[model samples]
Structures are given as C-alpha cells and as structure tokens.
Target: MNDEEQYSVWPHGTPVPAGWRSTGFSGDETTCLAHIDEVWTDLRPRGLREWLATRS
Candidate 1:
C-alpha cells in the first residue's frame, strides 16, 4: 500500500517502491489478489475519497 491506499503484488525479494509499504501479507499471486479484492472494497483513491467526504 501507499499514501493513496492502492494495493498491488510485488515480488518477495524485491525492494518495495519508495512510497509503498507491504501489508505484511505474502503469498502466491492468486492469494495476494484475493486478499486485495477482499480488503479493497472501495476503488476510489484516497484523494478522491477525502474530497467526496468534504462534499458530503
């Protein structure tokens, strides 16, 4: 995850990108993707969510 709350799968041994951190969940691609699907119920980015919140 990153400041935007987006999720993705990275290779186990590779360094995570500068802005992103691990969710501490590691597994095969299918499992990782399932985890993302389960947790990431809202697809909007952080900025969009915050902006929408202000509107509401």
Candidate 2:
C-alpha cells in the first residue's frame, strides 16, 4: 500500500503485474488473511488522507 492505502492481491506464483511490487509475503488463503489481518490494520482510503490534510 503506497502513501495511498490502496492494495492488490494476486494468486500464488502469479507474476507481479505492471506498476505493482511485492510486500515480500506469501501464503495460502488462511495464511494470507492472517498476514492481512496483522498488516492492514488501517482500512482508510487515500481520499481520507487528502481530506484530513485539507482540514488541517
């Protein structure tokens, strides 16, 4: 997730698509979800950042 909080997921062994990079983690469904659960604690979108910045 960039400064934007947008993210993408591809199946195991799939090539990384253009404009995307690996987060250096991989696993099966349960493992992947566990990783996401641990890492993606913030669900807010990039728009929220922009909005908050304007408010400041």
Question: How many clashes does the backbone of model 1 have?
Answer: 0
Worst 10 residues of 2 by lDDT: 1-10
How many steric clashes between backbone atoms does each model show? Answer: 0, 0
What is the per-residue lDDT of model 2 for residues 1-56, given as tens digits with 9 covering 90 to 100?
A: 44466566679788877657788777787887788788887678778968988998
Off by over 4 Å in 2: 1-3
The top-ranked prediction according to TM-score is 1
**Candidate 1, poorest ten consecutive residues by summed lDDT:** 2-11
Q: What is the C-alpha lDDT of each candidate?
A: 0.95, 0.75
Taking all chains together, each candidate's TM-score versus the true structure is: 0.95, 0.64
